[model samples]
Target: MCGTEEEMREVAGRICRNYLHGAWKTVEPQALGFRRISRVARRSVLRSNSFTMDEPKKVLLRIYGQVHGERAMDAIVTESVIFTLLSERRLGPKLHGVFSGGRIEQYIPELSEPALSMKIAEKMAAIHSMDVPLSKEPTWLWKTMGKWTRTVREERLSENIHGKSVDFEKEVEWLKKFIATVESPVAFCHNDMQE
Candidate 1:
């Protein structure tokens, strides 16, 4: 997002300083994996994954990288709202700060216990039960897929989307029909949910 690793650090350091201040002036954040969530946004974990602050003792932090693509700014704003809600619910890390290019989020520590699966299911159920001020109809996915299909068609890359030939228009129709058959009640779902 920042074009290079050095630039990424420079940007992240500035954002971190704006929030955490003091110690950051001395401590350089170690790099973790830079993972891409979508074409629009990128996120990288600053491992110390355990940054120590005078007030919080030790904490974790993440920097949401520069966002691009059409309507990307709107997407970031929407995501920030939902993310803040989830943080308030204790389902996610607290959003420390949000800036133009990205935001700072509390880092979550690694969780690896045998009961993790059960705990995750409980959390997901809670998330599903919650009401969010958004559309109730489960149509956003279809609309997004439709947009992706159009983009693919424009690029003339329709043949490789499914690892084989596919008719974008027909596939969208098939998906609409198939999804309509399932009784998926509307709720606050994560973007990463699968059918």
Candidate 2:
């Protein structure tokens, strides 16, 4: 379920109450210019309003089952990867805090054209510099991809396609094989980065 304005305000208030308790402050909820998925709390840039905070301060909060377990895991992994990159000064944004709920990060608001490009380049460089240790353990990428592909195929199959057939399994297998052949040095990856 999507959170209403009241719910969002409540969440923000709770964040302030729990983390910034007794600190000098005012809590004002401003609409952010982003589309957020309530399920995973994923935000994507879209045409919306912008909220200005007094300052971008970090706060920590708990993550309940409301957010998917896999999303939680992904957040943890992303935080760790970004932390290593930022410590080396290879990324633009600095991490403010990592809490049970999620991570808070800060970025310099003002940037010239050249500086922005430089920052992007630095982020890429950091990712390329990571050393990904080899593991005998199973990787989830293939399984996750397979599931995604299967879902797509099932959706297509359900659509009435007269006198037409698709080899869903074969296609999925080919894609899996192609993915397995790709090998690259591990680097810090944002996986998700946008305004």
Candidate 3:
């Protein structure tokens, strides 16, 4: 099933209440994709016969999509570890809580002005400089690409270049051969950098 807003709110509320401090008031869906984002706020109670309302301080609820149960667990664990490291280094958002499917993280505001290219490069350098406690084996890229290629072929999805069919399996084979020709160093990479 697609990730609905109601489902997102319910899950976010449950996560915030149990894992985070404060009385979580509401959860509003912000963005949705492979991962889901929601803004959660806390309730402020004021005394003295006054109908009081609190200013919303937002925190983000990030829910991971289900792929394969056991298979996905390792990836989640690795992500949690990496996020923790990055947050502590002030490179990524602060991690609030972790649940079965997802985690709560500090909400970062969108920048009104575009960052300088140098600043962006510095952040990327910092991320790459991190010595995360995960496997250094660079197998995930090829594995993921292979899996996607297989799925496409199995589903009989057509790809054409100039009205001629293209075989992804063969394409992958070609890439595998040509890829190693370029010397590339494996570093901690932000797989999802696009906003």
Which candidate tops lDDT?
1
Candidate 2: regions farther than 4 A off = 1-7, 20-66, 69-92, 107-114, 132-138, 152-164, 176-188
- TM-score, prediction 1: 0.68
**Residue by residue across 98-129, what tens digits does model 1's lDDT show?**
66766666654444454765676677788778
What TM-score does candidate 2 get on C-alpha atoms? 0.55
Listed per candidate, the RMSD to the true structure in angstroms reads: 5.3, 6.8, 7.3
- Model 1 regions lying over 4 Å from their true place: 1-10, 21-54, 57-60, 112-117, 158-165, 193-195
Kindly report which residue stretches of model 3 are placed more than 4 angstroms away from their true locations once superposed: 1-11, 22-56, 115-121, 158-162
> Clashing residue pairs in candidate 3, if any?
none
Model 3 poorest 10 in a row by lDDT: 41-50
| Cα lDDT tens digits for candidate 3, 139-158 | 88788878888788887774
Looking at model 1, the pairs that clash are: 60-107
Candidate number that wins on lDDT, 2 or 3:
3
